[model samples]
Target: MGSLGQHGSKGEIELRWYQGSFYWSRYKLILMNVRFESKSDIRPETLLVELMNFTMKETNYKRLCSTKTVSAVNDNFLGPTILVHKWDTFFANIHDRGKYGITIHWHGIRQLRNPWSDGLEKIMKCPVPSNTSFTQEIIFFIEEGTLWWHAHSDWSCTTIHGAIIILPALRTTYSFPKHYAEETIVPAKCYKGDVMTIIDEALTTGGDPKISDACTINGQPENLYDCSNIWNYISSTS
Candidate 1:
């Protein structure tokens, strides 16, 4: 999640965001293999622009000989900054390997005259192990657009994948409407039966769940100001 800049031999990046009342610094993010569950069950509005995150492993070509633990920090998310260093890479599993070794593929990028930098089987090397690690360098010169990163070694592909969006250069500016609306995100789960599951569970407990029957905005518990899990309102249609 570092910035994208010319840092001589090393690549350092930064990103920033405007919170409320003041500007807040957004940190670069690194995520492990965690299940991304959709509680709300609704695909929120996806904006035309996007952001991306990249992870590193010990067995990567660059880190193979090192003995250190890596962790993400705030500095990685800073915008108008350097996002990654040249030659930065990650290891991913192939189609259906036993998770023994992993492969690294740089999507939407061409390794400047270096085919070795291209992460492909039979052409390059085997996959990197889990406990062990590998080193990969970011290859610049790739155009910016809707892109993604994924595993190319084994079944690990199902989990070890993330987005890769290159932002517009600072020199350029994009136009937008003046009456833009802010976005809101919620978390929840929905099955084939809808909210009825709550009622069923309540009935199974020998009591009325007290859920509403129509579209509800923000509900409260016993007290209107309780602001807890109280069922406020319900929606007639989904």
Candidate 2:
């Protein structure tokens, strides 16, 4: 997943996966920050900070795989947007800098024997308290392809989620013919009003929360809305 900024500046990290490989030859670390301007309105804004140790052209796969720190933050959101290679080892030092407590779950990484890194709050361990950090080691023993990470507490996953791509290693053959290009799609919904308020109301009344006002593809809403003209123009032109 990429970053969605205050002025609608967009940033994305792309990973290409070949069919049947067990290692990755390239990796990029991305950091993102999302913020909600008003408590009642809850307009979410995003910022992306990319930290790279090396650079290579599109056709190359060498030197792209390495362990790096990828962190995402919001006033109310915290997690990592990861790009994992099959059979590679991943380590993350997650820190909760916000006022509330939180935990993260790797959506599809099969933690068959090791449940400690499963990231279930109170199931495996307690939530990481504010201003505290925890180190997690994720091993992609057998799984491959696309995965995601998000907050496991309450309704926070709505805006705190991102994509993970696992690619094949160098000299590895694919199960199928490799495509010319690859893309990651994240479908999400955003509410116009405060999400927590809606959740609280639902919990109190035992009813459905307020429906989301907008749907997004890759964190961008449809071009029909008033605030979406810039994106529409960019989409049309690009």
Candidate 3:
């Protein structure tokens, strides 16, 4: 007995076997598709009143201190940082609402044979202009784990980044024992001055620019620090 099976775009197979009784088999191919979209919201510059009163070591103040008395604050905000097994075919439709150009790079995604979705500006694609949108298809066959996405443009990445969690498929077992609960943590840095200004000053003066004034875990500074106490930490019950 013999049978033939054709899978869509992926591959095909032909099975042949001889037995006392005739036998036949059939197979079908199923494709998975997933899609996601992100918008870049660039908030206007503001001041951090708490950091305004704090001062660094007087010895290094000359190099690190800002000429202005207030701390500049401009953040690139995004919703829902963590993504689970949401889709099979991922389409990252990024809309740039910020003033500057931006692009997103899927940190751990193996582009596989799809280079168009790699999100490397100038190398693979161009930046998404302000007020415009760019859609990229992420096609990769790789292991499931923690991945990330971030702006590949300029200093925008400093604030425009998030975590990606790819869980095991349904009916699949973990390589290790499952835990009671899982939490994702992302640590980031914060600066008191405008990021663009800092870069410009460093490039033009050829000197060390001001360093970040604070550090944060998942975008929130420790409440124990000055001024940071205003930022509240809320736990999700769901």
Candidate 4:
């Protein structure tokens, strides 16, 4: 149900970057972009995320849980949660190990200096091709809270995403008391495909010509979401 890579965010860690590189032997992952493999409790480090055929069981509120296979980062059910300190700089190599190419967009963080790393497909750079890697320089200028990350490539992000938790820098404390316990929860929407199918049929019959083909899920096609936001929650731990 979960994958703990060599450089997971929790517990005692190993691996790190010297100058601006890493020891490739301890690496892992690739999604539409780089997955994270955190090391050292220090300010900066390079994380590895692999995107590949990831399979896991997801609970459906109305039915029994079923196992499904999809492209993922670091083989995690929900991509890994990236944990780092505020005002820190780290690197992540998004190695695409999936059937398709991808790009990673750090959802809301301000990349004032490293706009090139922004996963804006053609606007910034081409998608990281399958079986290749793209090194991203993540410089967090001003962000200190829970944010999200997802694939910026096509519909791939519909199944490849995760969360980013930025804590207070170094010896800094949060706004509230340290004694308060913290927890991270992922909220997902339960869907009914039948309704969308009705709408899709109406549009298809009335429209001059379908501008876009509807994506299929178990033989039924529907136009539900398009931002590829599905990737954001695909890699978080359950």
Q: CA lDDT of 53 in candidate 3? A: 12
Q: How far off is residue 184 in model 2, in Å?
A: 1.3
TM-score of each: 0.35, 0.63, 0.64, 0.55
| Model 4 alpha-carbon drift over 4 Å, by segment | 1-67, 189-238
- Model 2 is weakest, by summed lDDT over 10 consecutive residues, at 54-63
TM-score-superior candidate, 3 or 4: 3
Which window of 10 residues has the lowest lDDT sum in candidate 1?
71-80
Question: How many pairs of residues collide in each model?
Answer: 54, 6, 3, 18
User: Between prediction 1 and prediction 2, which has the larger TM-score?
Assistant: 2
lDDT of 4 by residue, 28-47 (tens): 11111232333332323222
Mind giving the per-residue lDDT tens digits that candidate 2 earns over 1-238? 3222223354333222243222112222221222222433221121112221111001111111222122235322122347755545577666676555767778888865557878888898787787787876666655667888776766656656777777653334467997887667676665555455668899999998888776755545556544543365356546
Residue 160 error for model 1, in Å? 1.2
The candidate with the higher TM-score, 1 or 3, is 3
Error of 1 at 109 (Å): 1.8
lDDT agreement of model 1 with the native: 0.34
Per-residue lDDT of candidate 3, residues 1-238 (tens digit): 2333333353333223344233222111111221112211111111000111111110111112233221111222322354444223456666665566767788888775568778888898888777677777664344477777767775655566677777654334578997897766666666666676788889899998788877766655556556552244444522
Candidate 1 residues lying further than 4 Å off, grouped into runs, are: 1-99, 174-238
lDDT per residue for candidate 1 within 48-112, as digits (tens), equals 12333334332211111232221111211111122332223332222322224555565576655
lDDT of each: 0.34, 0.53, 0.51, 0.53
> lDDT at 123 for candidate 4?
89
